[model samples]
Target: VAVTIPVSDDPTLPCLTFRFWVLATIFSILAAAVGAFNFLRYNQIALTTFAFILMSYPCGLLMAKILPSWKIGFYWPSDFLFARGTFIGGSLNPGPFNVKEQTLIIVAASTNLGAAYALDILSIQRLFFGPNQNPNNVGWAASLLLLWTTQCLGYSMAGLSRSWLVYPAAMWWPTNLVTANLLHIFHSDLQQEVVRDRLAVFKKITVLALVYELLPQFFAGYLSRISLVCLALGGASGKLGIAADYSPGRGTGVGIVTLDWAGVSQLGPLYTPLWAQMNVLISLMVSSWIFTPLLYVSDFWNAKSYPITSTGTFDNEFRPYDVSRVIDLQTHDLVVAKYDAYSPLMLNPAWAIVYAAGFAALSATLVHVFLFHGQELAEGFRSSRNPESEDVHVKMMRKYPEVPFTWYLATLVIFAALSIFLVEYWNTEFGMRWWGVLLAIAMAFIFLIPTGIILAISNATIGTNIIVELIYGFIDPGKAIANTVFKTYGFNSLHQAHALASDLKLGVYMKIPPKAMFISQFYGTIIGSIVNYAVMDMLIRNVKQIWYFTHHSPLAIDNHWNAQNPPVFYTASLIWGAIGPQRFFSGQYSVLYYGFLVGAIAPVLTWGLHRRFPGSGWNYVNFPIFFQYWGKAQSNGFANCLVSGFAASLTSQFWLKRHHRTWYDKYNYTVSAGLDSGSMFTAIIIYLV
Candidate 1:
């Protein structure tokens, strides 16, 4: 619902108009849960998931190209014309699109997508592992039962307070899953193997040293006060646009923090991005193109650190080039060839760094091997390119020793200063004639500082949009920038208006060809923007009276889903710290630095916690919701807990399971993309209709 227009007479029809659909989603969830369970147990092939993946590229490309080609553009002079990313929990007033209905549909689709993931993992095992391995061994039936039971409880509760269905907190299930993955990785057997080696002893010691020094710092202000401060700033500065006049009988609409179900939906479209399609494509293309090559380079160092084997995959063993085979002990036709592993130590660090520089390069390599490379290796054995026949160029890149810690710190300071300057530039709207562009460039540094630091530190990745949006808004608050400085007489908004330019720069650091990345991302964003806007407008228009902000309405978009509100809370906090009014503690400016602190130090913390007290994994695995005791009234506590357990257990089992190896292994990549693309497609379809 975009803007809630009230209708007091009809109690059943709120402004959102789709509350009934959300209620109906309970059935969809049930069906999906059952389907997912059956698919996982039986190792079923889901054409739906595969089709989505295969079609993603073509659809995105076509959509991007068609609109521009036909010049059938939905131009918005205002800043409200952005694209919706995933529909389930997007912002409400995302420019011109309010797509709450489509968002719910995507949420339903995601439930099914989860099922696809379960089954896909099994399919992988079946393809790669021998047929005898049990795909059903992962306790699929039990998982489904748990999911169903918890969902039932949630639905019953929602029925009692029907307004709880559309809140953002209600969508915490996915975030929990992400947190669970981090927890599992932190305590996985894989890390145990790394620590066992004599050569890696120094690495372990370094990790330990860092953890001890950083843990207290991490907890001190980084996790607690920084986030809260930012949220508060965003809320207080009117940056979030959440009404502050909630004094009873005094014309203060209810505070956003206290907004009801439909109210929270206003924030939905913030989840939308102009470049989602492009981002997905870039992620995939880089993974397939650049990351794959980096993985090959990784083998030079890693291939030799471990033994060389010929028969088994990385899951069963981490050995390089398996070559052993037993033929019933009769003919003994099996070949026993020995190949030497590459030694990365002999390679130049410069070369190694170049090879390893990509988003999630290491994780991508490992995941690709775990799910995909294994099958490719198997295929190589069966093909004409035998080990004895050809000199294959298969090498996994070694881990690059990063630049010294000092370099990252310097960058952080520089960026923070820059971000501050950008804010000043943006303040020109309030009569500060300070150069906006320079300030924007400077502020961009603040974000870049920690983004690089944490990313380089523990390889921890987090969203960078908070800084991006604030800076963009500050630098170019208007919808357009009329300047000839950056190449042409360019006209683009400070934020999404310059998406092409910003992404072009990002693509450069990530090793993507500037032109291709620019084109792909721009194409995807524009196309997605139109469709997202159209669908959102339609849904909001149809449900206008239901979602507006009013006393009688069950849900209101203004206080809840608007982009200028919730996220603004954080932006304001950052600005306050830089300015020093609300900045009480010494670490006020250090808030952005926390991103680096958290990302860099997380691995060490996890390791130390595990060492000091084993089984800390299970406890720490439940990520506490910071600040708020009860997140947006719509959130289901049980659902998040259930999803966390399910994601971890299921992911772990897929890694361990022998059967359905092919499917199980490829689950992560396929499912992430599949759901994203499927929902995008559904959104477009809705727009078209």
Candidate 2:
């Protein structure tokens, strides 16, 4: 019954730095050289799945270190950075292409859930769970179409609420601040000659570096494996072996084994501001390096049998738990006879702690927001009713006609019909019923405002997956796949709404025409949906390692896709979906469910301290955002990646900003753009070649 929760943890990258091409060139060489060797020696690319994504995280960090805030602005072809690269890639086709926000919005609107979560869902249902059939072979096209319909249903719901969310200035989706600021370098009057020149140079450098990674991507497949730890330890270090765990790809530990950029960079430091990176560093060091190691050594959860940091749970014998073997095909219930034989759930102490922190973060976010901005939020909703009360951005947006709510209503109606077919007519054996979809929609409605409130204030977000999954975990207890389906409807739509609202907010900030934004988004939606579908299909077909399980063992791991948070997702689903919170989180794990209450109360306590001791800096105790960093390791290791990132920011943000004000202003974001551009260009090139 284990299923992955398809929630997007929106990270707030402070747009300030593009600092490091100096190291990028070196990493590029390593990637190329090893990529070439691997191809020649093994006749395969050394790194196949999402190598580019790994490289961008560090590039941003490196850039932020060298570049002061004012020094530079924007990632090269900035639109191409981040998860939005798919649409940006389609739009930024060579020859004077304008990477307009309107165009980006269009692509974004088109790019739906089909691109990201569908493959994982199908992989879970078919490869890992039941039938062991190729997703492409059975009702695959219909499944995709149906999923897209559900996506539209979510988008339509978001559109209907635009008047309340988008028109309000206080509902400033913080993530869009980065995007808006970068886009302004071109669209706004602030386009400086220096900025344009830097962007041009960066663009050229990106293409060259990207092209060079071809060697590592194709020929020298070994270049991506510049793991000094693996080489030194021969990758055979036994139980609790730190050396074997240091490398990016090889290790179960959270330290860096090599300086290879291809192997190490997973945080997008280039676009992230220095301060945020510092916070991340502090959190990861305390948790991953210090806390995680201690817990693992202490046999936390009796976890010494497994890796110190992993997303997948294992049995007593340390085997990957196969829920498919335990799930009843007909009733979709847990086979009670087989259940007792199954291992009790065990998580890497790091992951378990992270999940627990996530729970805290969820509650902390609500309390913190209420304490800090409750007045402003109340005013924002009122502002929609009284146009004169609007914020500056919304007022400026008034000149342009608004995108009518009718468009959204129509979209919802159409998509809801499609979803009905998916729920009732589609192969029903799996049991994603009509009521589940209705429940999903209802959950989406309840969480949207609170989630939106959190997103507006802090670019940071905790996924609705926890809330939505928790709800369905109780309501639809034994229906594993149905639970996942319901979750996508409930959470993904809310996430999609946030994105839409973010875009609308960005438009208001830049004063883009609402009608134009709507049209562009609609067009982009079409383009993104089709292109994402094609790419997903291509990747699934070509990368069998990602879609298919290679073996049946406790450590039946898929290096490419499995590492990218799906296993973590599977664990989440197992806890809330299959096992249900009652038994799975009961007794020793009871705290997991009650985490919501703890999170809520913790903030109130902090707020009291702040109000009572105004001068004591109690206000700075931001537990929610602080706790958010705990769950980051499941995405990237903390040791070297985090420490180096922190160092880079410390000098630039704290030291330089304080003492060397002139230097800091001149180069703050410029340097980050350089390094990030170099790194990503290398990855894109590597991926292409």
Candidate 3:
């Protein structure tokens, strides 16, 4: 903590001042709009929190310079003839744009950095399923309620887990450390030689990255993924028998390399721990290069008959399954006779392994956290209750009043009730009972701490989407809406909770008031949710060709707005909801069921091995990360950036950390922030131009 985050406090600094509110609100709206707009694009660009951090500083300083310092007051007039008014006044601009104000603005904007997860549920529903596939049929009230409830429920969970997740120094979120460090550099005394040097480096890198991005992103796109093996084999469609094996654009991307920082930094090589990166690389090598190739060559599950990598489900004849044929038009459920007469659902080898890996990753997270970090978590929980055991950062934060527990509790209750009401009252459309809401919440709550622990330390997360789909699939099979709604509530709530927790820890590090942090995040979430729904509605209604499954549009040319996510989402609904996991996981896919058991056992064995050989670095082999990344390439497409990612990780984390400690400490995170900011800026510019 001392090495990464400054141990200091200046309580008098203005946090929720007039300038802060104006900037926060503006950035919050912008972030939401940008996030939602890019979500449907083929090459999706996340307007990352680093971008928020970089952009907000200048805007805050500009506002501080331009806005008047004169006091502005709110007045309410009395009804009497001799009227009197109650007045509240504050300066238009706060003293100076301090760290607290900057932190609040960043937090607010960052909260809405991506489109709401519930939008996926809405997209799949409107684009692919049922009579309501038409955007006009989807009700605004129901959509808003679904979006807001799922987005907010996690705030409650985040509040409930704050003691263990945020206050404890042991649960240090690695990602936030980068944010904190960059913010400190931005706000530090520029007069200092060291600070000036660091800032210069940051600026130079940002410009260099921006200029370099154009080469790969535009002029020579082939520079993004250069595969020597593919060239050696002749080409993407070479006459060589195994030409597809090394084609990064169409195949598994074995031995592919990327010169683009945007591609290399996708997995956060500079920031994520070396062990975590290694685990992912090891898993990728074994699964994509070795295991998947072996399976494809052997025609495992008749893999050679279909594309080596595809998210779309296939029919027995090896074509894209025509979902409309098996689904009833009116009821929207699977027509048993049609499905039986048609053919069983088929998955490519890679996609099948992706599901199996997802199952293992989820179960492995629970067991891993239980066996390894269980004791530390217990202590943190107890320490949270007893404030005397607080660390320096938490101790410093005690001067400011904390957000009351009841605030989160009340918010949780209100949203939870609204969720239940929507599902039950609109059961015809949602296809979920009130109990399903409860079940979804229960699942989110169960995995919160376990997943939080992994994310905090490793900068890697294990999602509950697969497990939630599987469990709910069995409980309420043949209802696509129910599966999607349940998955949204279950998966998104947990995800949002962790996002809140991460920001809260950032607040702790920065000494921002807990109440101010809560307000910023809560407000951002509401604003983002509204903007997300509005954008989704507009796109669905106006776009001539949105999804390829329904129709193709010019926007899909060169994969601009091809609508990749919705198809994958729609496929999961069919596999897990309409066809039912019970049927889909039977016969040929029965081996997938063992994934859960394998996931559970792998962690136990690792834990035992660590105990037996404490010095062997056994503890660093996180099974959850390994399993999660094992089949990541199948869903994420070819391993186009794997070589570059590994190179960056080793260069920064291994070589620089050991050989050039001083330069690494002062400039590593700044470089990361600059590169990300530059790449994002370039992408946004490219889109607009």
Number of the predicted model whose lDDT against the real structure is largest: 3
Encode model 3's per-residue lDDT on 323-348: one tens digit a residue.
77898776668889999899888888
Tens digits of per-residue lDDT for model 1 on 123-222? 2222222223333322333222222221222211221111111111111112222212221222224544431332233234334433432322222322
Off by over 4 Å in 2: 1-114, 123-145, 157-279, 329-333, 383-391, 427-430, 531-576, 615-617, 638-640, 656-667
Across residues 525-613, which tens digit of lDDT does each residue of candidate 2 receive?
44444444455455545655654433234453554343333444554555566677555555566666566777788878878987888
lDDT for 645 in candidate 3 is: 90
Q: How good is model 2 by TM-score?
A: 0.71
lDDT of 1: 0.26
- Global lDDT scores for all candidate models: 0.26, 0.54, 0.82
Instruction: Tell me each candidate's TM-score.
Output: 0.27, 0.71, 0.93
- What ranking of all candidate models by lDDT puts the best one first? 3, 2, 1
- Total residue pair clashes for candidate 3: 0
Best candidate (score: TM-score): 3
